[model samples]
Target: MAFSNPFQTYQKQAVSTSRPEELTYMLYQGLVKYIRIAKNSLENKNFEESNTFILRSQDILSELMITLKTGYPVTDSLLSMYDYMKARLIQANINKDQQILEEVETYAVELSETWYNAMKEMKIKN
Candidate 1:
């Protein structure tokens, strides 16, 4: 996104293009990566690695909200989501449950979809 206006970069996408979908996919990939790391770490009883991935996932979520320019409603929801995700990460670390990591991944995917849809609505086509 090397543009003077970041929003403009998103707007330039072709109507038939897959960039928007790709973005969603990319977010999912990130979620999968982090969650997988989390699962492996939790399975090995590596609390630190699990914690790290959780924090990374949280950071990605924060960046997603900022990128989407989400309004109050979305912002409020994101706040709750972020809190829940962080809590889950901590719980996964403590309980060493791979399932908990998968649950968090589900939330991440949902959030990505929501963010991409919201941004699509706001985009001003070129």
Candidate 2:
């Protein structure tokens, strides 16, 4: 019998049960996490590992972009921000620049904070 990793199983369950807003919050969390690890790897002069992490974070940003609903003014602004972030990530990966990763991390933090607070407000109002 193949033993499944408990953490992986738990993560799949958590995702399956989460609401849309919760999933968005989770994506932001993952993005920030990947960016931080990439930054650390870059700082340590581990270029290959940094590239892998940055690409993983970029994929999350792409997912966020793909799922954005149309007809809302906020969506346009968010699209722009996501595009900028992805571009910055590409540049950071190519250059192996820790500073660029830090800048991207700041944006990720802002996005996650704003998203989380908005969700909390929505919950209270509902």
Candidate 3:
């Protein structure tokens, strides 16, 4: 018999039960986290770890971009922002630039906060 980590199990259940808005919030949080880790790794001179984290952040951005629904006015703007962030991540990864990572982190943080607020407003309405 194999044992699973309790935290991992809890996380899986949480994600499985979350609404789409919650999932988007989670992704934004993840993007910020990966960017922060990449920045720290770069600061520590860990090129490989930094590269890996930056790539993870870019993947999250790609996921966000692909999941956007069509016919919404905001969708196009959000897609553009995601594309810009991914480009910055690529530049950060290539140059190992902490400043570029910080810029992306700023955007990720803002998006995460905005999403959280929107969720709150939605819950209030419902």
Better by TM-score, candidate 2 or 1:
2
Candidate 2 vs candidate 3: which has greater TM-score? 2
Worst 10 residues of 2 by lDDT: 93-102
Q: Can you give the TM-score per candidate against the true fold?
A: 0.56, 0.98, 0.97
- Which runs in model 3 stand beyond 4 Å of their true positions? none
Task: Give me the runs in candidate 2 sitting further than 4 Å from their true place.
Answer: none
Per residue, candidate 1 scores C-alpha lDDT tens digits across 16-117 of 366655665565568768888877877788888788887787676665555554567866776677677878877876677788888988877676677667
Error of 1 at 28 (Å): 6.9
- Over 1-126, each residue of candidate 2 has an lDDT whose tens digit, in order, gives 999999999999999999999999999999999999999999999889999999999999999999999678999999999999999999999888888999999999999999999998998999
Candidate 3 per-residue C-alpha lDDT over 15-119 given as tens digits, one digit per residue, 9 for 90 to 100: 999999999999999999999999999999999999999999999999999899967889989998999999999999988889999999999999999999999
Q: Model 2 compared with the native: what TM-score? A: 0.98
Candidate 3 to native Cα RMSD, angstroms = 0.8
Q: Give the number of the best model, judged by lDDT.
A: 2
lDDT scores of the candidates, listed in order: 0.71, 0.96, 0.95
* Clashes per candidate (backbone, < 3 Å): 0, 0, 0
lDDT of 3 at 77: 92
